[model samples]
Target: MNENFKLLNKKIKILHLIQHMKIGGGQKALTNIISSTSISFEHVVVSTFNQYESELNKLNSSFIDCEKKNILKIIREEAPDIIHYHWWPGFKMIPKNKIPHNCGIIVTVQDPTPVEDIQADIYISGSNFINLFQKHIDGKKRIVIKSYIDVREFTLKKKKNTEIIIGRHSTIYKNKIPENYIKTLLDFSLKAKFIIAGDGESKIIEKLNLEIIKNNAQNKIEIWPGEKIKEMLSICDIFLYITPDDSFEGFANVISEAMVAGIPVIAENKGGNSEQIIHGKTGFLCTGYNEARDFCQLLIEDRILRLKMGGNSKKRGLTFDHTIMGKQYDQIYTNLVKLNNKEKQ
Candidate 1:
């Protein structure tokens, strides 16, 4: 639909509530959604915590940084058609009676667990694998919509023939990498260059540094603060997505980003990673460190297989476009509004 036509219609006012607009999967996903959505939808972001200036300024919608006590007041005053809550913290902050019964409540599930006892008209999940594990949500409308990116921007870069670059980008605090996993990565550092990118507590970084030093793999292992991820993925030949046993990664956006950059991934067979990796095709899903090690080594040793898998990854990654994702959510919003109107009549 044309922008002018969309503008002429009665726009559905959306109050998107999240904990913070930090550099994370859910935050970026919401940003992509609002930016790609048609002008017919009016989006207002309400964050309980602080937001990154760059990310907050990027959106065209109005943003509100409010205290817990004021959140319900803002919602009631704004009287938005849809309350699209993302984070668990955001869900907890909602007061029961503040929202009018006719208002549509939609909760976007980004973690393995949804907020218990929260009343929502629709529950939006980012992956089918994550949705399968959801037990907290009852009798709510469920829809699976995977995270998306503009795959075109992350073009494939020809990796160095002599050196294979293995990269992993994540908030390390949530990652519960076993000591044995570190040893396994160090073992791979013997043949390939390893890059661990992401900012975390100083203690965690120091611990990782100590592990690298103890293994005498400092030359091959590079641990640094996270930068533009696409830049990191461009030179990377393979990606390592090993999270702890109890990881709550609803949809691993980093895995999708790496795939878009034509990099093969080897992820732990848990969380939303199952939905992203095509096991043995686009990438491998391993059950343990041993399995992960074998897959990593295979990609490192076989150049032809690496290229083939990378191509397949890109092909699969292209299927997840942000524009398409926005349209799907738009349809859900439209239906919810119609349902609300019908109930009133």
Candidate 2:
């Protein structure tokens, strides 16, 4: 549709709420979403925490930071048609009295929080498990819409001769240690270079004999951490997405990115990852942290199989795209708006 036509149809003001629009891919993806969706829809971001211009510009999002105001004043000023929340901390801050009575609520549940009891008029989850649990929701309009990305920006490159890469910096959950994965790579001792890309609390530099190439010493994991995310995706032959979370991972954006990049992945068979990556086809599921290195070795030895799986991953990732996700949100918003109007009448 043309820009003028889209604007002329009905411009619904969307107040997107997030805890912190910084740090992780989930947050970044949300930012990207608002930017892309805002072209057709009226959107305003309500970030509970920091709202950096640098970060906002990356996603092409404009907004009002929620930290400065009492709930009443903020809601009144924005006068949002709907409150589409992404993070839980921000959801808690939504005052009941301040909430617009006529406006319907639609929430995108990304991760399982410590929070319980609080509800949305329309609840959406990123995976099927969350969707199934929606039957228990008080609201009738619960749904699931995966957090998908623009696959075009992350086209699968026939990997540049198996230089496998991993983002291993700033580790959060130790149980899902990349050290176990590192050991797996070391065991193979293949000609293909294996690199850890993320900065971590672990003393990784001292442990690995490999030189930490200066991308930036501050983050530590020896990376060329450029703004261009797709370049990193394009070069990697296999991606290691081994974050071992037992209870929750609403969705694995990086795993999906790797798949979009068409790199074979090895993700732990836990949390939402099991749903994100199809076993044997998109990636492998490591049941043991102890055996991570063994799996790495297996891949290093097998070239043709690795490429075939990588090819499959790319094909699967296309199914998860922003266009599909956006349309689902469009339907939800349209339904919510209609429902709210009916209630008013």
Best-matching candidate per TM-score = 1
**Which candidate number would show the highest lDDT if scored against the true structure?**
1
- Alpha carbon deviation, residue 223, candidate 1 (Å): 1.4
* Model 1 spans > 4 angstroms off: 2-8, 89-97, 100-102, 135-140, 159-161, 176-181
- Model 2: which residue pairs collide? 168-198, 169-198, 169-199, 170-199, 170-200, 184-293
Model 1 lDDT at residue 214:
86
> lDDT tens digits, residues 235-268, model 1?
7888988877767577777788788888888988
- Candidate 2 regions exceeding 4 Å error are 1-9, 35-38, 48-60, 89-101, 131-136, 156-159, 162-192, 198-221, 224-228, 244-247
Give lDDT per model, in order: 0.76, 0.62
What TM-score against the true fold does each predicted structure earn?
0.88, 0.80
